[model samples]
Each structure stands twice: as structure tokens, then as C-alpha cells.
Target: MSKIDSSLFMSPVKQIVIGNIRKDTTIEDLKDCFSQLIKKHDVSFRIAVDKKGKQKGFAAVSIPITLVNDFLNYNGRNMKGHRITVVLSEDFKISKSTRWQQEETGVFKTPSPNQYNSLRSMPFLYKLFDAGVYLTHPKFSKNALNVIERAQSCGVKKMVVLGANVHQCEQALGLCRLFSGSLFCTAGLGPKHAPFWTDEAETQLTQIASSGHCVAIGECGLDLSTDELSSSQSQQLYAFEKQIQLSIKLKKPLVVIEKQAHIETLSLLQKYKDQLVDVVVSFVPENKAQIVKYVQEGFYIYIHGNVFLPQNSCIKKWLTDSDEETNVPFDRLLLGSAAPYHSVFRCTDIDWYPRQFTDDTQHKSFDIMLKHCKDNYSEPCSLPSMLVMMCCMVGDRFTPRSLAEKLTQNAVTFFHLDKSVGEEASVKVTGEKFCNKTPASHHRRWSFFVVTALVVVAAVVLLGVVCVKYSVLDKVGALYNLL
Candidate 1:
């Protein structure tokens, strides 16, 4: 199928910040003024307001970057008898707080095991629960259900299951259904998964898209991270274009995953920018320039636990060194763990999770449901810890609460995840109900021991008392006692 041309929508969209907004400036009044000035009815407008239902003397309007020149020609124009100063939104920083955490020099310290044990009792635990976390790109795995279960217990109320290949796309579809409305997914071949791409791949994706099983169409894009291309750069590019076309055709957002191929991927996306609902840059790239480029392009950036890894130090450096013109806008940022089971819980230092407890008392439960969760390929963080870190210690671009809330709302607005959790059950958990849902870890361990003991007894009885001596049996008994 022929695709849309880049010239049609390649023009960037910039947010126009209007300060000294009149207190009486209603949304309709501002919208009417922009609609009249631009001679278009579709301009997006919003006014910043404080908690007391009062206007904050500022508002923003989103319009085509091409029209920014025309819009600025009227910069000092009067509206509602108040002259408004219009300019492109400043490169947003966590400028609101001088003492906030710096991604560069700030140390990211994971809470100790004892700290984890006390989480159930900490007053901050309720805050974490209420803030809620959104996982924008959790890859579906064999232990998908277990991961989902643990994520819910950890206060991740919603997530997007990213489909990397055909198999995973199908698995993600099942997960979306299994979780009912709590999970959504993307359907496409990522660069790594595109090695086997074929016409059938697009066909499958089309069907998945038509079924409304996917909110975005990706985990797809270009990647030139390695010394040589995975299949051929051409093949990855072809697969990317196909998925982009599918996203545009379906009019869904695109979950973009570009590593070393940012320029090429962004160039491809420019073609369908008009039709695409949201363009999310999936992970933090090592190159700061790429991040600046994406932010300038007005694409939403998805950050994962990888940001905390030492190997990803460049990402941290970018946030620190960026000035007013290049800072990442908080409104355009979103959080996702590329693979929640493996990538979600990540930090530079300690890897620990809150102790599981029983229903009535604070007695620690020993059941390790996700034993394989320990062999993490990324910095480990529980979903709750990741949310806490993002709010309190990740960046200085915005106040902790504001940045955290903006990122959460970004995910909701971008991917269109459920937002009822915000109003209905923001912080409803009261006590141990948070940790008691899963089975006890110690009981599971003892069950394994009991089964092993039965097998050992059976072996002894069948050995005719000749394979080993009674002294060996005494040693075995002693070892069992030690256990």
C-alpha cells in the first residue's frame, strides 16, 4: 500500500506558553482567541491552575511549528484586556526546585533489606501506593501471569505489554485478555524481531490491530547499535515503515524503539506524524544528542530502569548538562520497563523487595514466587521503588510530586490507559493486604524439602541397604537437621 508522504505532516508541533494570563481567562476564551488568530478550529489549549481552583497566570497552546512564526507576530496582542507574552515553552527543566535530585551527581541508594522489611509499616508506603506506577512496555514472558500478579501487589495498576515478535504479540494478546482492561499491548516486529519479517507478519499485525487488542503499533523501529546491522539495515527499515504505516492506517499511537538509529527512525515517523496519535521513544539512548533531537521533535520519551545502570551514564549526563534550550520537558516524559519482569526493578545499588507478610499479623512469609526474578539483566527495582525513585531522586527538572504525576498522566494520555484508578482507588490499601496475597515463601521451600526427603527415603529403601552404610544415613540425618 502507498504510504503518506513526509511533506504532509513533517512540520513539528510546538507548545506556545502564554504567561501573565488573566485570572479570568477561561479555556474557551483562550481557545477562541487562538482559533481566530490561526484561522483554525483545532488548536489545543490548556490553562495551568493551582489546587485552589485558581488560574496560575499562565496557559499553553499547541500549534504547528510552521505556524509559530505567524503566531509570534501577534506576541503582544491583547486578550481579555490583558496583554499576553507569547513564546515557545522554555526547554523544561526541574527548575522548580534547586534542592531536587540531580541525575548526574546525586547518588541513587537502594533501601537496605531492613528498610524493605519495614515498608509495610512506613507512612511513605501509603504515598507510594497512592501515586501508582504505570509500566508502558513490559514484554510478555513465560511467567507473564506471575509477573502481572506481583506487579499488582506492588501497586502497578496498569501496564502495556510490548510485543517484540509474532509469538510475543500473541502472548501479549492473551495477557491483555487475561488482565481484562488492566493491560494493553503493542503489535509489531522490533528491529531484533524483524529478522524473520514477512508479508504474513504485517497481516498478523493488521488482524491484531483490527481486533483492538493493541493500543500502539510497535516495539518496532530501527536499531544500528551493533557494529553491523542485524539482518540488513534495509530490512529493519522496511519493517519499521510497514509498522508505521499500520499505526497510521489504524490511527493508533506508535511505541517506538530506536537505539542507534534515532535519526532514521524519526525521519520515517515524520511521514505519518499527522495521523499518529502519540510517538513514544521507548528507552533512553546513550547519545544525548538523540535525546535532545527527540525532545525537540516533541515525541514522548519512555524511561526504564536502564537509566540507573552505570553503562547508561550518558543519559544521566544529558539531564545534568542540558540548559534551557535542550532540557527534556516533563510533560513529554513517560516511564516503562522495556521488560517489567527483567527490567522494571532496577537501581544502581541494592536489589531488595519488601518482605511478604501474612493477613492478620506482620509475620514474614518466605514464599519466593518468582525465584527467577533474581537473575536480573538490568538494575533491579520493585515497581513501587521505581516510582519512589522517579519522584524523589531521579531528576531535578520538576518538583518530585509534579514530575511524578505528570509522567503518570503522560502515560495515561499517550497510550490511553485506564485513569479511573486515579479517582476511585488512589490509595485504598490499609494494611498487610498489600503483601499477603501471595503464598508464603518459607512454606514453598519446606514443601520442596518434604518432596526431596520422600525421594531420598524411597531411594534408601530400594538400595537394599547395600548402596550406602548406616553411617552415611546418620550424616544425611545430621545435614537435614542443619537445614
Candidate 2:
């Protein structure tokens, strides 16, 4: 191939290979971070990988030809804590003899050194992973897969699938397996599945925890919207307690779904506070005291889709007050789509639809909104675009980048997904085993001893009383014979 003029690299689809990318970094992460460099243009990114499926520490990104110069100017920027080297396709192929080649060359050429240095250095940008959606479970497995695929494309990489029961837990895990992206799941009986426990339920959950798919035991807590009798209340409490212990035994975090019974849930959590690994309390409580208590306990507070609604004044107040006074640090905050279920108030929930399609009111999906942005449309905001604005408004330091990165980091750390890939594979759970040990092993041992002692004392007392009664009856019989 003759020396191809660098001008051809400026076509609507330009190829730039990014180097030194972390192994865990995905194509979605790259697109999310790099898109910010040229928000005015439409870009599609895909990473190069070896046959083994491990990232080759480099990626090829194609952006609008008009913005090729803009991306080329961003050559030496940092992404996900790594300073990367961006190279043009022609230069890369000439240097490495790679497969990517072009036969057509235009007058476009690399900028002169004087001209390049004259261009201002890219701003000191901070880049990190995209925000995670904490709970997402569509009614159908196919729907769940669709949401996951779209979510991954939109830079929503991490997600937690909520399992209200064994069937749901199975479905959630199935979805996790389907997504080539990273995902964590929580398995346990939620309040809705409570008070109707079967003997096989715990066994099924034991298998779930052992399956290595579950990272948390939750969506389990009290919900007392009905006027139930004492027996029903006992069942709900028993269900929650059982899952709480299961969480401790399995050494997993607990995702508490609190409703009208905040106080009861709090008290129960306090009782097992030392045993649990980590706690994430979902849903917004109207009472500020509950928020304070949860914060003081070092629990993560999940902000759901309601925060995007115009009617959720409480959520707004909480996000606004998420500073020194509230003790709600950015790292302690999390975001979730909670798809298919919005609060009583109207809010934007993520759903699947035709590609580039909008709702009845022209509210488009996040991916579609990105297209509008690329076209430079200045129409009224859509739900997806509103979410971006919401992130800026509610995030720490009131910046979109900070909030997105912080929430993603929080999810990754809480689930312990930062470990080595080999470690992750080695510890993969099969859900066949039960918790033979736990952080609360000492407490369980003491409990067994105490119960054994009480039973022994009761038996000894009953034996003594019986012997005394027999002696008295014998004395009465002797006296009657003497008479």
C-alpha cells in the first residue's frame, strides 16, 4: 500500500486506537468517557480483544469525520484512571502492520508539530465508570435482556437484579448469565413473598447463595400497609429475620426494601448489625429521622427514579441536603433505575421501545436522546436527557462526571467486584451449599449452649417435683395402714 495521506483519517468514521486500557474497562466505559471529549459529535466505540476474550489494552473508536480533528486533539487524555495514548488508524497500521487499512487517501494530513503544539492541551478531565442501576427486573426474561443490552449501550454497566422469590431469583441469575457485561444479583424473599414460607424456600435460597451468582441477600424487609393480625406480623418478621441470618451466614450484603415499617426494619437490622457485611437501604422515607439513622449506621441510601420527578419534593430536599448536615457522602449514595415500578408519583422509568423512538410526547430513550444531541437539537428535554441533568443537580459537587463515577465506584466496591478475574472465577458460587460458617459463628454457638442449658434445668426441676409427690403419697399410705 502506497503511503496513504493522513487526510483520509478525517472521514465521518475515523479510527483511533486507545492504549493502556485497564482489563476491566469495557467498550461502553470507553464510549461514555470519550464522548464527553466531543459531545458535539456522534461517536461509536469498540475495543479490540484477543481470542481469549481478554481486552487487548487498546480500542478502535470511530467518530464523525467532522470531529476527527477534535478527537485527534484529545490524543493524550486519561480514562478510568489510566493515561491513554490515542493513535490514528493509518499511523497505527503502518507502525504495527495491523489489519485495518485504507486504499483511499484524501488531502487530509497530520497537523504540523507547530500547529499541534499551538492547539491548547485538552482540559484536565476526570473520568471513571458509569453510574450503576441498583435494581432492574423486567416481567419477562427477554425484556430483562433487552433492558440490559440497551443499558450497557447507554453506559449503564453495573446493575443489581432484585429477586423477590426463588423463581424471581432464578430469573435474575439467568439474566445475569445472559449479559456479557458485569452484573450482580440479590436473592431473598421480599415482604410480598413473606408469611407464606414453604419448607423448601430456605433450601432453595441456600442453593441461590451457593450458586455464586448472588452478591447480596435482600429486597427483604417489612412492609406493613395492611392491618394484619399478630400471627401475620410474626410471619413477616420471621421471614425478614431468616433472610438477615442467611445474609450473615453467607457473608453477603443486605439490600433492605423498607416501606411503612421503617421502625420495625431498623430495629431488626440493629439486632443483626454486627453480623451483616454491608447494608443498602432502598426507597425514600418521608421521615428525616430514618434517613439520619441509616446514615449514622453507615448504610448506603439508594436514590430511585422518583428523584427525577417534579413531584418528589422530599427526594429533592434530601439530595439538596446531602452535605455536611446530612452526613450523606457521595460515596455512600447509589442510583437505580428500579424499572417498571415508579413511586406513587409520576417519574421517568427506563423501558424498551423501537430504536430512536420516542414516547407519545417525544420523550426519547437515552440512546435516542444522544442522537438528538449529536444533531444539535435544542428541543425541550426528554426523560433520558432529564436524567443527565438530574445527575448534575443531585450529584456531589453538582457535576455530572463526579456523581456518575462515584455511584459506579460505590456499586463496584460494595459488591466486591474489584477482585482479580481469576479470584472471581474461583469463588463462583454454585448455590448447592449452605452457610456452614459465618461472621456470627460465635453468636450461633453461644445460642446453642444457652438453649441446651435451659432445657436441662427444666427437666431437672420436673423430675424433683415428681419424686417429692411420690414420697408424700407413700407416707399417706403408711399412716392409713397403721390406723
lDDT against the true structure, per candidate, is 0.57, 0.56
Q: What local lDDT score does residue 74 receive in model 2, on the 0 to 100 scale?
A: 61
Question: So what's the TM-score on candidate 1?
Answer: 0.53
For candidate 1, give the lDDT: 0.57
Q: Give the least accurate 10-residue stretch of model 2, judged by summed lDDT.
A: 113-122
How many clashes (backbone N, Cα, C below 3 Å) per candidate?
14, 10
Query: TM-score for every candidate vs. truth?
Result: 0.53, 0.53
Per-residue lDDT tens digits for candidate 2, residues 1-483, read 122233322122335666778877875677676766767655555555444445556666654444555666666788888987776654553212122211133122232211111122112122222222323343332233334434433444345667787777765564454331355567788887797667799988777766555777877888777676333667889989999999899888888887777788889999999888989887657766778788888888876655555665565666667567775566777666555454212333223223323333223234344443222121111223434545545645545445555665676667665443211441222111111123244687899999999999999998779879789668878999999
Per-residue alpha-carbon lDDT of candidate 1 for residues 20-131, written as tens digits (9 for 90 to 100): 7688777677766777566753565665554444556766666654466666666788888888777655422111211211123333222211111122222123211211
Alpha carbon lDDT at 70, candidate 2 = 61
